[model samples]
Target: MSSRKAEPREYHGAAGGFGSLQGIARIELKERAGPGAAETLYRQNKPEGHMCTSCAWAKPPNPHLAEFCENGAKATLWDLTSERCTPEWISRHTVTELRERSGYELEMRGRLTEPMRYDAGTDRYVRASWDEAFAAIGAELHRLDPKSVTFYASGKAALEPSYLYAVFARAYGHNNLPDSSNMCHETTSVGLKKVVGSPVGTCTLQDLDHCDAIFYLGQNPGTNSPRLLRPLMQAAKRGCKIITFNPLREKGLLEFIDPQDPVAMLTQKPTKMSHMYMQVKPGGDIAALMGVIKRVLEIDDEAKEKGLARTLDDAFLAEHTHGFDALRHTVENTGWDAIEANSGIARADLERAGDVYAGAKNVIGIYGMGLTQHVHGSQAIGMLVNLLLLNGNIGRQGAGCTPIRGHSNVQGQRTVGITEKTKLAPVEKYRELLDLETPEEDGHTTVEFLEALLDGSNKGFIGLGGNLAQAVPDHERVHRAWGEMELTVHIATKLNKTHLMPGKSSWILPCLVRAEEDMQASGRQTVTMEDSFSHIYGSIGKRKPASEQLKSETAIVAGLAKATLAHRETRNPKLAWDEWTGDYARIRDLIAHTFPDEFHDMNGRMNQPGGFYRGNGAHDRIWKTDSGKAEFTDPTVLNACGIGEADGRFHLVTVRSNDQFNTTVYGHSDRLRGLEGTRMMVMINPDDMERHGLADGDLVTLIGDAEDDMERTVRGLKVTPYRLPDGCLAGYFPELNPLVPLWYHDKLSKTPASKGIPVRIVKE
Candidate 1:
């Protein structure tokens, strides 16, 4: 095979102008959604249309006429493409043939049009009736112990199906309800619960408007969540001091041009985004945060000694917080020498950041996978909170921690009870209201889910949406796990690798996309979704279904539930599976009843164009903690990748390309990085590249070794020289995801340690 060549071009600013429009058009045209693209985009942002599945960034209280960004447009268009996949066409391509195609190639093939079952005899997917698929799944589920069944969901699914997914698992006597959150922002949930007594970000999306200082730690907003750039640009224009710490100085973080602004587009001049940029090495977030906290404490002491207003909030601390003195002691005891050496940031820089942080009356600290996809991800997240609480940042206007979540409605999934660790409150409430007796024992997480599949413990799997096999690490081992499952079912839209690699008895239950209308017995129905900030709103798809046979995920789940729960429904007569499928508003009422305090008036409130807030206690400074006060936590010196310089190993962090969203590959190009026509590229510092005797465009192999000394290799990744911190290398994921061992994750969250992996590079 010939190596694909790509040319590098520099991006001067963040999203806006012709580039954003052109990028959207490129994929729309590729998917053949060009004719009605404008109308589709209109409904995508309109009140009557579905929510943007691109980013979970909260929508405005009153959204503008134009609400979505370029990425949202791309996401909507991709899902509502004109192309369709038929059983005849699917049968034409064998599993082996499909396996050879790239993930991008598979998605581009078009939407799955009909229910299909794997026929191993012919090595092809043949059409199956909905009844046939459900019966098979129900039979398999009944054969296995409820404890052996795993009910998984994707971040893309709206609230209705996610609710049914959780309810179905519990009613069937299992707690193995794992979703995308386990692989993404679970650390934020775990860490925040310990510190602020809340699992979600304290600040709402509108709160960013009040912040005078914004600290971005190890996140690239441009590529991951482009919609976030709009507020960052507005904040910069208002003269807010924005400081960034990451291995790469992303173009989006450096400058931005609001395509919404006419003058900026005409002038080619961009808004200066980051006033200060610190290129801290990977695995340094914990140390860097401690360094900032130590500096802040030192300033507070000096101010107190001078009889001036102190850096720490005295009244807030005395009344609403605990363990401050111990946290301060830890920060002060962590030597400056260790902080600087570990963080790859100078002490003077930390002091400067502290000055900026103190100068601004309101501040917000934001982070992404770079903080949570590590061995000590939970500890790292708590350290950020410790830094924020020193000045009482939480509950302050325009000031708090924002764990920028990826994927739409991922937070909502957790809010409605799709978790491995089932809480007693929600479980008890469901049993009381729904008249159901569900399991109490907690189930497996994402890593543990696959591990169970590999062992004999787990025998069945049902996915709501997403390419699970591709998203998890240790691809080969995951394949082995799939092969072990007695039955597998996928509620998906696009044809991906996971569908091709099926269990002994597998079914591809093609479902409706968010961009298409989901009509049922009660007529056209609308589902509810909550954003990252907990703004709950209604999403009604306007576009007609791509195929007549396509069913909503809600309907699919309902049919499954109706069939599966037939035997157990005598005692639980209130289980209204049919009503939920008929009118999604009924699901909202059930949800309101299940979570009364947070979800009151669910049916009426969601109808409002702007939606409603679920209300976080942190937003009100009412910490629902064990002590009824916000608590301080001691910082831990976590080794992100567990690599030593003497070993000649590089810290590898898996990343998404500019054109990709989660596992969906729009194209091979990453516009922000100026790389096009390929995704098989690895970036390393010039010094490290030279040390390995490699040059730009040179092909190299990446090797990851386990503690058992078992070697796993990904061959022929082209090297690209970057201005990264020494000992750090970056590559696009789904490709590098295999290098991350299943065991290498945050002890609490179990999120894939995709942000940091230890590997050695060898010339191919």
Candidate 2:
């Protein structure tokens, strides 16, 4: 559907409840899957059904009758649609013609029905058998060094399939397993590992029950993880304080509605979630955190002098942590003037928030891209850990750090071994299982993979699932690099932009979505997924496949892998690929063989009440860090205003509309932001607009201003005056992703600094 003009309407209530009901109802009508659609929605995250493909929010033991959210409906309906893209449709349209549609429309057209291969002669995809596609791909793969190949995992992949991909890639002799996490939560992984020895979040969902305070630092759960609103509202109702530190006012964090609660729907009353919402400037979160910690140290000093209980958890700090004395001294010496200037938070507000944090018995810190997508992302995350450790907030019933992961299984995929920088699990374990030596060299990350593609170091890419070209920053450069690849294969269920821009020769291997029944040779199969909180469980699709030609991801990967590996000397028939493909339980057994501590007896453990928890050692007052204790890191953050000397540049933070999740745009309307039907505008503070002599809808061109005068610009954006911090602009991603420089990334995590782009707004 082409975007319509001006239907901007304000949603004057808590997010969710009726709004969610309306969203599901609307999507239900669009899909016309009938009563079964209702069953489909209800069965999601429940036993004998699928987990949500929308986000990685932790699931409760018992799912609500409506066990899904607004965005969840979009994700399910979009994947479970009745529409199909047949080879006939491909023949009718050329590659150039199909490339014109937005990613939303391409996906809305529905599931890909059959295997197809690109025909250079006709510029169209021609029907091909599974064997033909696999053989062609295998032939090309055999000729290249494994180092020239990259396997990118989408967030949608279930843990079983993800594990297979990882094992298969390494067994084939390469570790180039770049994934969606590399783009989103790589900083969290790098930062948390350095601080707590765990790459995942330290807290579990059960922590929310006893939580006293929740801080949102650059995180907006409203759009990213709507299911988190329920717990947030429950905490608020129980007198828990929710403090927010974001550049813009996010609706979900401000207020929430429990869609599952009948009283909430009838009363129409909203639960105000945030006790204090600070409009922290772009890239000011780390500084704001330091400001709060500085005040906390002061509060602790005063409390000790008054002969009262100290704010600092001295006992826990002395026992489980190191470097507290030095960190406390450094924070005490920090000037309030510098903190305010850098953090964009007043000293008084910081003190107020600090007092609340120090008073709370249990505190939980929540964050998302805003915290991780910065130049000093790892340092900021370390500060978050440091903030929690000051009061021993972690390793308790209701305290810890949370990174709101988007996509259903992005974190799960990471846990199961989709990594680039290093081996997730021991290589010796997999070497015996696969009967092959794993690659010793480090692999390519998303950015590094792209760099390799351009330099002719990498030639082939196998995308398990995801829109690599659309999702990455510097879109034009990424697309150009894709053209240089020798081969590009996308195993997907829909037609995305990445599929349109194929390599010299490309193949579209249509595969099964999670909601579709994957009947393998063994019998009906079930795939497992890990949530944001590291809860692992099984999910089985109930609906019939849209097309018989469609194959399960496991089957596709298995078939191609069998064909490709057969030609290599490393191939071993005794590895029993057929058995693993036939019954996914065999795959689980293989995984358990590797990670026995977590997945041992995988099939037996998943049938438990709420599945199994991948334990975090840091949550139990056990330190697995390199130093055997939690080490304090200095929280020194720079501010945009102070860093620039009267430069006309604005600090732009790329954001998603309420209708969008990751790169998937459900619709053009963003009701929460009062936008009716357009993605061609940027959100700016009215004060900033006034300073620039700009009006509400002024057309402007934006340029990325790096320190060395490097040029990166996105043009023709209509300004939408919003309630934002002064000198900060908000724009939608994938579109605004072009404005993010590929070189501007966190040095430690290698995640692009998408949230803190320095931009100069000029009237066009």
Candidate 3:
């Protein structure tokens, strides 16, 4: 309990003004990119340079000189650092010693200079040749059954590598391909697909320009996707109402100063971002959404009774949707008391939200991990889709659901067939392009794959990128399981905690990042990525590779595939691995050939300015579902709040600090939350702290409320009072991931319920 303490202060300044510039300057100085900072920042998110690896906010058709945000600069500078994690430097530290370092410290050690192999004899990583590493990995992979080997990818990879990875996995004869999507936006895919017949968001960047109202649910844009703040500010300036529903009044949603706007930056007068901020409690999004829908319906009925203009789009409902009557009945039959109790919002406020929603001609529903990382995440997403469906907001100029993605190419990975589901994989395309028949059996998701690792069903792991050991829930359990694997290979630009959890035969293959030049036999190659808006674009790194020994992800995957399949008997003989690695265009050609509809002219279109759209069927009102129309989920079957009956336990939501992105930590400070020098602090309501006999900086231990009888606990967390709803607590992830049992996830999507985790906070 004595190990935790934090410097907490109140931040009255708006998001993204001088604060962002200061943060950017700090990172640039720390990374020694000060001299080249202007050039690097200006080139980010531009057609001529590499894409920003931070977040997947769509690039505007006409981007500003400083198109990137503070986090984007952090990612770019972090990759552009002069430090190197050479084999000699790594040999000085033991695995146990390296494991004790923080994620930020480990990553800051610098980029991996070459391949490394774990030596159990010395308990340290030793230098290994690329060919030797690949051969050893391939031998182990060949020895194990395809089902026992899982191929995991991080969204940080570009499209060329992602496509090659999926093709190699399918060609290897199993579907155990789980990527970053499974952890972050899988629920968005699962929930939206059921209703609109498309697994991606329907809205584009252009939609923000014309929307009358933008409803933000469980989203903090300032930290998650700062580039989005510009559009939101523009919309607000044009009189568009921005309504936000979240547990905390995130500063980003309250106000913002556009760093790109010269006048706003000079004056320091913040632009009001949100017209209405609904501070809903954890696990209350579904109930709150239902409450709003009920009021909208009630108002529509009143208008009908008065023979006035109908509030609901009756024509769209009749011709374009199904199960409306059932949905209406369920909403009407539900009592106001249940809605008010579950949502923690009064009837009057719900009606007011409904009034704004009903008055808007076009409304866009924007959400993030808050809506997807819960016990009932899919249902929450479905409810949002249904709300937009009510007013015929979808398939319009400025409306539809948009799930802001955290990774730059997470969607692109999925689009190129990185999925565990047999139905979701591009099976026919693989058969056509690679002359291989993919396995039809459904494979493991991120959760299921980890379970496989724990149960001994899976013995091999091949990570294209990411720090899975820390990214998933039940961090300790997952890390222990990883150490028992037969072979574990990580393809990354730098060292991470995952590299320290060495298996029986472990290796690290350093690859070129998106911000570095990736030279191949075809010459300096450009890679592609798909944003949250389904815009596929190219990225050509301007800087030289961190090390000449490093290989591009495409080359690494191709090398491994060639070596592994050499040992196994396969029907496919024309894989052209050498040719594909030599020319990235061949990979893109295969991708275009496989998903013709989405990537038809990929090679030509990917490099074009602003890229080309991977058109969404739902956006065109062309439902591809069995019913051939948008389907409404039966509301009776959905839970209002899946966290369970109210008790003395506090609902803990694990969140990312402003200094971190996903599992990657950049620094110890969170400027937005006004917490510095530590990530071990918890934010709780003032009333809850008083009830628990706790004061600011008091240490506490949170106990999991899982029924599995697992003893999950995290101690030495400093409590800081905040404006969160009573009985709700917020803390950083990975640190608190231990309290989230591996089983605590959405049953349908299998995404970890990082939000709304029921736990007992006991002061130490």
lDDT (0 to 1) per candidate: 0.82, 0.82, 0.86
Q: Candidate 1's residue-wise lDDT over 372-471, tens digit each?
A: 8888888888888888887889997899988898878898988988888867238787878888777768898888998887777888889989888999
Per-prediction backbone clash count:
0, 0, 0
Candidate 2 lDDT over residue span 695-756, tens digit each? 76779998877665556777889978788777788888889887777777886878988888
Off by over 4 Å in 3: 1-9, 569-571, 637-641
- Among these predicted structures, which one has the highest lDDT? 3
Tens-place lDDT per residue, model 3, 404-500, is 9998999989988889988888877677766788888988999999899879898989999999888888877888888999999999988999999
Poorest lDDT segment (10 consecutive residues) of candidate 3 = 1-10
Per TM-score, the best of the predicted structures is 3
- Model 1 pairs whose backbones collide: none
Clashing pairs in 2: none
Which of the predicted structures, 1 or 3, would earn the higher lDDT when compared with the native? 3
Q: How do all models score by TM-score?
A: 0.97, 0.97, 0.98
lDDT of 3 at 165: 90
lDDT for 355 (candidate 2): 87
